[model samples]
Target: MNVISDQRVRRGRKFGQVLDGARKVFMRDGFERASVDDIAREAGVSKATIYAYFPDKQLLFLEVARGECLRQTEEAEAMVTAEVPVRTALTIAAERIVAFQLSDFGQRMFRIVVGEGERFPGLGRQFHDFGPGLIHARLVHHLGSYVAQGALRIDDLDLAADQFAQLCKASIHEKLIFSMTETITPELARRSVHGAVDMFLARYGVGG
Candidate 1:
C-alpha cells in the first residue's frame, strides 16, 4: 500500500508550518495523545488550514516522521564520499548510526512507532523503510563499490551492510532502548563506532 496519499494533501506555503507544528506536538504528546487542535495552535494556523493540507492526524504524523528520517539519511549519505577511504567511510557511517540511535529524536521516534505499531502496522513499516531500510540500502551500495575495487571482499553485500549497522549498536542501543541508561558519553559512543569499524574491516577488508 502507498505510505501516503499525495493527492489528498494540497501543497501550500503553510504546508511546512503544519508539519512543523505537528512534529512538536507529536514529540511532546506522542501519536495517540497529540491532537489536531494542538497542532493547529502550535503551527499558528487555523484548524481548517491543517485539514486542507492533511486529511487526517495519522497521515500528518507519518509525514512528519518520514521527513525527519529523510533529513538524517541525507546528512549521513553526504558525509560518505567516493574519495574517502573505505575504513574512513565505514567509520563515518557507523558513527552516524550510533549517534542517531542515542539521540532524543531517534529514541522518541522508536518508542512512538513500537508503541503504536500493532494498531497501525503501516507506521512501523514506513519507519523501517525510511530509516533502517534506507540505511541498509545505502550501505550495500557503498560496500558494493568498494568490493568492485577489491578493497573489500564481501560475499554478501546485504548481510555485510546489516552486520556493520548492528555492530554500531553493540553496547549503546540496547541500554538506551531498555531505559537502562539515561545518557551515553562521548567515550562510549566512540568505543562503539571504532569497534564496529574494526570488526567489519577485519572480516570484509582485503587479505582478511
Candidate 2:
C-alpha cells in the first residue's frame, strides 16, 4: 500500500487503542462519569489525539460500542458455520451470545445504546445491520439450504430465520439481561440449547 494508506491504517490502529480504553472506562465509570481526559490517559494518548479521533466522550463511547457489536456478530456468524451438528452449532452460538451480552461489557453497551440512542442515531442501526441483521441472514441462508435438501420444513424462510435466531439466543438471554439473573452454568447453557432445539423442532421440523 501507499504511504498515505499506511498512515491512515496506523492512525486507525492508534485510535482503536483509544476506543478500547474508552469502553473499559465507560463500563467501569459509566458514561456520565467518564471524561475524555480519562480515556486519553488510559489509552496513553493526549487529549488532543482523542479529540482528533472522536469529537467528544459520547462519540468515543459509541465508536467502541459499534466495534464491539460488529465484532461479536462476526464471531457469532463464524461459530454458526463450523462443521458440527446443526443442533450443536446453534447451541454454542447461543451460549457465546449470552456470555457476550450478559458480561459487564455487554450490559454497559446495552445501557449506552438504550439511554443515548436518540443522541446517536446510527448506533442502533449499526447493530441492526451487523448484529442481528447479519446473523438472521446467515441463518436463513444455511437453514434454507437444509429446507431445500429436505432436511427441514421452512415455509416462511424469513420468519423462520428470525425465529431460529430468537429461539437459539433469546430464552436464557432475556432472563439474564432483564431479570437480574445470576450466573449461567455450563449445565444451564446446555439445557437451554437442548430445550430450545427440541421446542423449535416440534414447531418447525419436517416430521412434525
Candidate 3:
C-alpha cells in the first residue's frame, strides 16, 4: 500500500511540473509555435515523461485551461449563494469577474483560445464549458434562488445572468482585450461592479 501511494504521489508531482512547463511555453509561444520539445526542456523532464502524462499537446492545453477555469470558479463560488442579498452578491461576483478577466493569465488564455480555437476546436469548447459556461450556470442557480425569495423578478434566469455578466464587463472588457489598457485596480473593479449591480437591480429588482 505504501509503495503504491508513494508512486501515485510521485506521479502527481511530475504531472504538476509538466503542466507548469507547458503553461509557460504556451504563454510565451502561443499554441501553434510551441513544441513538445520545449515543454519537456522547460519542465526539466524527458519528452517521454510529458507524453506519458498527456497524449498530445491539445490535451495538455485543455488541462491548463481547465485549471484556470477551476481556479476562478472555486474563488467565486463563495460569492454567489442564497444567503447574501441579491445586490451585494452580484456586486461581489462582478468585481471578481472583472478582476480575473483583466489579469495577465486570463488575457493570455483568452488570446490563446481566440488565436488557436479555429485550428483546434476543442480548445474553445474546453474553455467555454469549464469557464464561462460554468459561471453562467452557477449564476442562473443563484438568481433563481433570488426569484424564489422575491428579491428580484427575473423571468429568464439565463438571459438575466448573461446580461448581468455583460454589464459587469461592459465598461472595460473590450479595452483589456485589446490591450488598450494594462492596469486594473481594486477601485476600478469596485466602480465597475457597483455600476453593473445598480443597473441590473434597476432592471430586475422586485420593486422595479
Winner by lDDT: 1
Instruction: Residues 1-208, candidate 2: write the lDDT tens digits.
Output: 0111111222455777887788788887876678887888888988878777665455565566657767776776676643555666556556655566557787666776666567656666654554456666766787776677565777898997777666656556667667656776777766766776777777767754
* lDDT, residue 59, model 2: 53
lDDT of each: 0.86, 0.66, 0.80
Over the stretch 1-208, how does candidate 1's per-residue lDDT look in tens digits? Answer: 3356545666798999899999899989998899888999999999999998888776787788778777877897798777888989888898888888987778888899999888775778867776678788988999999999888999999999989999999999889988898789999999999999999999989975
For model 3, the stretches where C-alpha displacement exceeds 4 angstroms are 1-13, 79-81
* lDDT for residue 127 in candidate 3, whole number 0-100: 71
Per-candidate Cα RMSD to the true structure, in Å, reads 2.1, 5.8, 6.2
lDDT of 2: 0.66
Candidate 1 runs further than 4 Å off: 1-10
Distance (Å) between predicted and true CA of 162, model 1?
Answer: 1.4
Q: In candidate 2, list every pair of residues with a backbone clash.
A: none
Question: Residue 122 error for model 1, in Å?
Answer: 2.3
* Top TM-score hit: 1
Off by over 4 Å in 2: 1-11, 56-59, 79-84, 118-126, 169-171, 178-180
Over 1-208, each residue of candidate 3 has an lDDT whose tens digit, in order, gives 0111111222455998898999999989998899999999999999989877776677777677767767787787766666888777887788777877877777888898898877876667767776778788878988888899999998889899999989988768887877677776778777888999999999999875
Error of 3 at 119 (Å): 2.5
